[model samples]
Target: MIRVVLAEDQAMVRGAFAQLLDLQPDVTVVATAGDGDEALAAVAEHRPDVLLTDIEMPGRTGLDVAQELQGEQTRVLIITTFARSGYLRRAMDAGVAGYVLKDAPIAELVSALRRVHAGERVVAPELAMAAWDSADPLTPRERELLQEVTTGASNADIAVRLNLAEGTVRNYLSTAMAKLGARNRSEAANTARERGWL
Candidate 1:
């Protein structure tokens, strides 16, 4: 049997996934975790063949957890609600073997798990297309500034929040806007959000 570890912050979602996997003839849910730290601990304790995790969780992000645990014994599969291109890119960089959307059909998820267990890469095709088409080449600092702007904060407010000078914030915002091809701050925010950049 393919031993699986499930890690999701939402109680209902975690239970549902566990139950679904448990019903599969060739798979078993050996461990379940509600956060990134627990997920890592479970992996160490259970040493499951595959780890299915949500990207955003308390304590440590899924990317961090995956980066830490990815190895010959355990394959990492990231499951997320937000199909952010940046998150996917980071997960891929962390050597995640599979990336599945939370809303994807259970069959797809099962296939993804099986593929990853067999040392194959799995990424949701739709998400892959969207990510490819909407790629925004934002530097880390520019992305951070864009995220701050998404809160509808004034320039001074963002400066204080990010501990950056107002002029520096303006420069970052301008750079982000230019990269996103947006005409104004509001437009930039909207564009970034639409592309899942913020």
Candidate 2:
């Protein structure tokens, strides 16, 4: 049997995936997690063959988990609603075995999981092509500042949370806005998110 660890923030989605995946004769839902941290814990405990997760969730994002698990035995497969090429590119860089949209049919998702387990890369054709169109321009610090900007947090607040100077936060935001060709902080955040940079 193919052991699987399904991770999604939404309880209903997690339960549904668990139930549906469990019904597959060749697959077993070894564990289900509601957040990235829990998903990592589950993977460590179960040593599943696949980690199927959404991009965004509480704690670390799925991309973060994938980055941490690179070179491990378990394969990572992202199942998310975000179709932005930037996210896909980041997933590929993190060594994720597959990237499948949440709207894909369950059968296709299962196929992707199996393929990923078999060491084959899987991604939507268009997305795989688009992922190379333009690389993400912002650095990690810039991305973090922009993410906080989207939350409507002040530079001072973000500074305190990130343990950076308020001036540093402002500078990062400015750099991110310039790189994204955004007119303002809000616009910068929106542009980054639209491009899946944030």
Candidate 3:
């Protein structure tokens, strides 16, 4: 059997995925988790052949779990709502076995899981093209600041959270804006998010 562990924040989605995978003759839903940290625990305990996870979660992201489990036996397949090129790039960089969007056909998702479990890389074609077309432009700190901005944090709040001077925060924001050609902070945040930099 191809044992699988699924991680998604939404309970309904998680349950639906579990039920669907469980119905496959060769695949078994060995465990399910509601967040990244729980997913990690499930992986450790079950040591499943495949990990199907959403990229965004409350405790840890699927990307974070993939990074943590790098080079291990468990293969990771990221399924997320966001199909940003940046996220695809990050998943590939972290050595995830597959990356697919949530809106993809269920058959494709099932096939991706099997392919990934069989030691093949599976990336959505459109996302792959987008990832190839756009390179990550933001510095690590700049991306960090953008992430904070995405959470609706003010410049002062970001400065305090990141332990930077308010002026330094502004400088980073400005640099990111220039690099991304954003008109303002909100625009910068939106741009970064769309690019998956945040």
lDDT per model vs. reference: 0.87, 0.91, 0.93
Superior by lDDT: candidate 1 or candidate 3:
3
In candidate 3, what are the lDDT values of residues 1-198, reduced to their tens digit? 999999999999999999988889999999999999999999999999999999989978999999999989999999998879999989988889999999988899999999999899999998999898999899999999988998899999999998999999999999999999999988998998887877
- Where does candidate 1 stray beyond 4 Å? 70-72, 147-166, 181-194
How much is 147 displaced in model 3, in angstroms?
A: 1.6
lDDT (tens digit, per residue) of candidate 1 on 1-198: 999999999999999999999999999999999999999999999999999999878888788899997565899999989877867777888899989999989998999999999999999987787778766688878877777777788989999988989999999888888888899887888887665554
Error of 2 at 82 (Å): 0.7
lDDT, candidate 1, residue 32?
94
TM-score of 1: 0.80
lDDT leaderboard ranking:
3, 2, 1
C-alpha TM-scores of all predictions: 0.80, 0.88, 0.92
Q: Alpha carbon lDDT of residue 7, candidate 1?
A: 95
Stronger candidate by TM-score (2 vs 3): 3
Q: Native-vs-model 2 lDDT?
A: 0.91
List where candidate 3 sits over 4 angstroms from the true fold. Answer: none
**Each prediction's Cα RMSD?**
3.0, 2.1, 1.6
Cα lDDT for residue 168, candidate 1: 90
- Candidate 1 pairs with clashing backbones: none
- Worst 10-residue lDDT window for candidate 1 reads 189-198
Please state the error at residue 198 of candidate 1 in Å: 5.0
